[model samples]
Target: MSGHVIAIDGGGTSCRAALADAEGRVLGRGKRGSANIFTTSDTIGENIAAAAREAVCDAGLEGLPLKSIPAFLGLAGINVGERQRELAKALPFADTKFVHDGVIALQGALGDEDGVIAILGTGSVYLSRAGGVSRSIGGWGFAIGDQASGAVIGRALLQQALLAHDGVREHTPLSRAVMKRFEGNPEAMVEFAQQTARPADYGAFAPLMFEHDEKGDVLARDILLDAVRDITMALDAIVFEGCERLCLLGGLAGEYRKRLSPRHSAILQEPRGDALSGAVQLALRAFPPQAVGENG
Candidate 1:
């Protein structure tokens, strides 16, 4: 068995990896592009390996062979299909475990304590753990679900831009700005959203929405209002009666928190750590490091 462990927290937006010793001390970290199995499965293995390679090289451990390492990959879109299993087979790790991205987010948010986590990133998912059992609420991804995700929010903005352009709706400043990005051509938005855009591509527009929201742009307010409703519905389903912890995670987490109702505010709090931290902890437990020397 490899004495060293590799931990990954990958999603539609990016893949992050950490190299740690047996004692779970992080030596180096690396980041790469999307690892979403649903849309990017063809390159999932490559992205994972590339991130791992970068981590090792970042730590100046290029001398250690990756094929001998054990890895834990917490990836997005693993629940929708069998692609994760196939992707794992192509990875360089000697032993690897696959889990839904929400699993690691939950672990990072609540640790061993039973609680709930709503990951609101480029994609979204909700998970709750209680009484030694865990359950998932939603996370169907962009094609079908992911209602409260950045991708969804951004797509809605562009779609609204088209609505404004066509005179179906009043064009707010936010809509005008969106149209400007497309060079005032609705066809460009169509081509991008329909032909070439991935979830991250849409998600890239999320920050602009948030920025516009802060300025009290009517279009931004409307979009976030709808997204928050989706978040509330999911939270209501996943939060149990005795739930003590409720953590909002991912890139849009804090933004959503500001918009959500105060109903669960008492339980809502910051996570002790992040997904990568949880991955490292799990890695050390599952594959205990041997006496630290040349990665054993």
Candidate 2:
């Protein structure tokens, strides 16, 4: 256990860590609050350290020495090189490899093979790999982009409500539901938003839209359709030229697979693993046994 490898999925809403051996057997797992660098740098270092410690302890390695293991951290919004270096230097792992959250999620799902992975969480992103080349689309934070994300859906619903309140559109059941959720008029809505949490806080409303869509609500159907299309477009943008495998990750994407466009459906293949399992894969990759080691 002292020579264990750790894999982390540090995302916007939560961080998950897995401890695994050279053969990819998961020894332990741990979870913590959000660790997105974009929003939580104030405590990112401590959060990572705590998560690692917890994971190791869960793996029954609390008595072992520190700096005894190599670890791989898959972080959200780590597309920039500088950020990767900063996080690697900041974390406590002996040897650390940093990659985009989507990249690791893709790896978790597809191993080292070429494929596209679309993630639909509080935020959204698409990643693809082929011939050792990698590319990504969308995931530009919650404000400007992140199409198909829960935050975006919530924001859209709120905006539509605002328009209805301002007489910009006819009031509909969706608008009514939104207004009721906030319990306010236009000015009150603004005040509530100012004092409330971020766009992510509203992401919980995404399911309501889905429910409405199932009930044949036109706007809800449009929103759901648009989410599927956006997610597909993001995946389509980066799928390997010759690769035909596509894997959708995240709660929403996996659940809505049946709703995806037929063309997208045609290209997708089943994922072999999840992010946690991918973490185990990454751990084994980082800490392979000697050519003659027992687990090798």
Candidate 1: stretches off by over 4 Å: 289-296
Clashes of each: 0, 1
lDDT of each residue in 24-140, candidate 2, tens digit only:
778878888777877777777677778878888998889754377787878777764466667677777777777778877888777888878888888888878878677888777
In order, the Cα lDDT scores of the candidates are: 0.89, 0.77
TM-score, prediction 1: 0.95
Error of 2 at 279 (Å): 2.5
Per-residue alpha-carbon lDDT of candidate 1 for residues 206-291, written as tens digits (9 for 90 to 100): 99999999999999999999999889888899999889889999899888888888887778989989999888888887777655
Pick the TM-score winner.
1
Runs of candidate 2 exceeding 4 Å displacement: 240-242, 290-296
lDDT of 1 at 16: 98
Report per-prediction Cα RMSD to one decimal. Answer: 2.0, 2.4
